[model samples]
Target: MVAGIQLRIGILTQREIPSESEGSEERAKVHVSINPFPSLIPSELSKMSTEKERETHVYLAKLAEQAERYEEMVESMKQVAKLDVELTVEERNLLSVGYKNVIGARRASWRIMSSIEQKEESKGNEHNVKLIKGYRQKVEDELSKICSDILTIIDKHLIPSSGSGEATVFYYKMKGDYFRYLAEFKTDQDRKEAAEQSLKGYEAASATANTELPSTHPIRLGLALNFSVFYYEIMNSPERACHLAKQAFDEAISELDTLSEESYKDSTLIMQLLRDNLTLWTSDLPEDGGEDNPKAEESSKSAEAQEH
Candidate 1:
């Protein structure tokens, strides 16, 4: 007779193991089985399989952005972008935008803090000034690195094709913004180089927009306004600034007449802003100058009256 022992494993059925007796006729039996852990049920297996489908990083990024936690938002967005799964073009674009926004915010913060540090230094608060300086340097270095990474992303993923008009326009516009911030915060030589780079970017964006979009498009008008500001404030060219401002204002007014009432209402604030810019830029021009340009004189008169 063979002695047998029964064994139960996990959720599997029980099986018997036979043991040899002293008699020569006794036989031994072998059992083969596979049993998953008792703790892993159907629901748990489903959850595990669906892990890649979870957009938790994206959700966290949006939440962090809403909370103004820019650094955390950047990290979350990076995690989302680096996932093992392939991303859609739209998703990649979103990641790029998130990085751009965070980098811009970081640059702006550093500028503000640097200004504060300068004020503190002027007040003879060496201790606080030193702390602020150190913090600002760290932020500047980190933001510079992030800016370079974003530029790479723009070049490689966002607008890999030079013929992609819309994407190229967006990329150059962002490049303009990045260089403008760099110009504002860098040393004299670096500032000049950054300013030149900024102008090049703005010009490229403007050219691409003019070629691909309508003259009265919001993007064209916005680009004109930005160029005006750049010329007036950064380049110290008041005449060019006034000319671009006038162009933007005229285009906005012309576009306004073609829109429906609802659309007109939606654009009213932008139109008002354009008008304000016209007035501001006109006032910035030399009172006794531009006598040879009749159009400029007429525009100046119109802007002065429109402000009321």
Candidate 2:
């Protein structure tokens, strides 16, 4: 199972962003009467006014996202971004959805290749080991480029234009997420720098979310969810992770009545995720010491629930 969950951000009534294909009807419903893609005369897009062109690109981007054609989505959103106007929440989500899918595949491949390389080295297969390492490096380079590109957009465009609100919190959360991806494979000083930057981004997001957004707001809960995850996975601080998760879960529970119908589903889903992690982490915590040893209680628990 995937160890941690990612935030599913979208406009009201939008379902969680699907990993595979989402219906084009749902996307088209979001924006009607827009021109479709190349099959329907691509030249007409250029002939449209700049405003119309931007609208077309945004529509295309959303459609590409639903189709999981992320490269096409990125191309279309890049055109939208070039207009240099403040991106609406849906546009920001579309941009992130595109880049994340593109980069996520590379990150997954790099991890698998790294594991294979280690096994090849153990088997004294130098040729296979070298090839795996080389491929992993290439994947890492691509990941770095993708992460850098998005981070630049967040700092240069998104952050400046987003004053103080959920948008600002959302941008900072994205900044942290990309930095965490960078820290996953980087080494030495580079890894340290990436980790520090990731921490800064998450911390800024937490501060802003706490002040500006309600406890039951999907963006705020999502920030807490990811920030606690950073503590556990990146910082190796299960104690801090549990504390943060518990705090957020508790606070959100207190405000459960305040959750609007539009956000109720996303908010509750994230809250459930936070609760699940808390259960996992708390059970794994060391019994006799302050130090967190997540594996300490695993064997006993496994023995109790053994199935063979």
Off by over 4 Å in 1: 1-64, 75-101, 121-131, 161-164, 259-269, 279-283, 290-308
> What C-alpha lDDT, on a 0 to 100 scale, does residue 205 get in candidate 1?
92
Clashing pairs in 1: none
Tens digits of lDDT, candidate 2, 1-308: 32223333432332223232443222222222334453556556554666788899999998887898998998898777776677887788788778878987897698788778888999999999888888888999999999998898888777887865888888898888889889878999999999999999999998899899999988888878878777776677778878988899899999999889988988888888888878777765667857865433311211000000
As for model 1, its CA RMSD to the true structure in angstroms is: 9.5
lDDT of each: 0.63, 0.77
Error of 2 at 62 (Å): 2.0
lDDT of 1 by residue, 148-179 (tens): 66666555544554445655666686677667
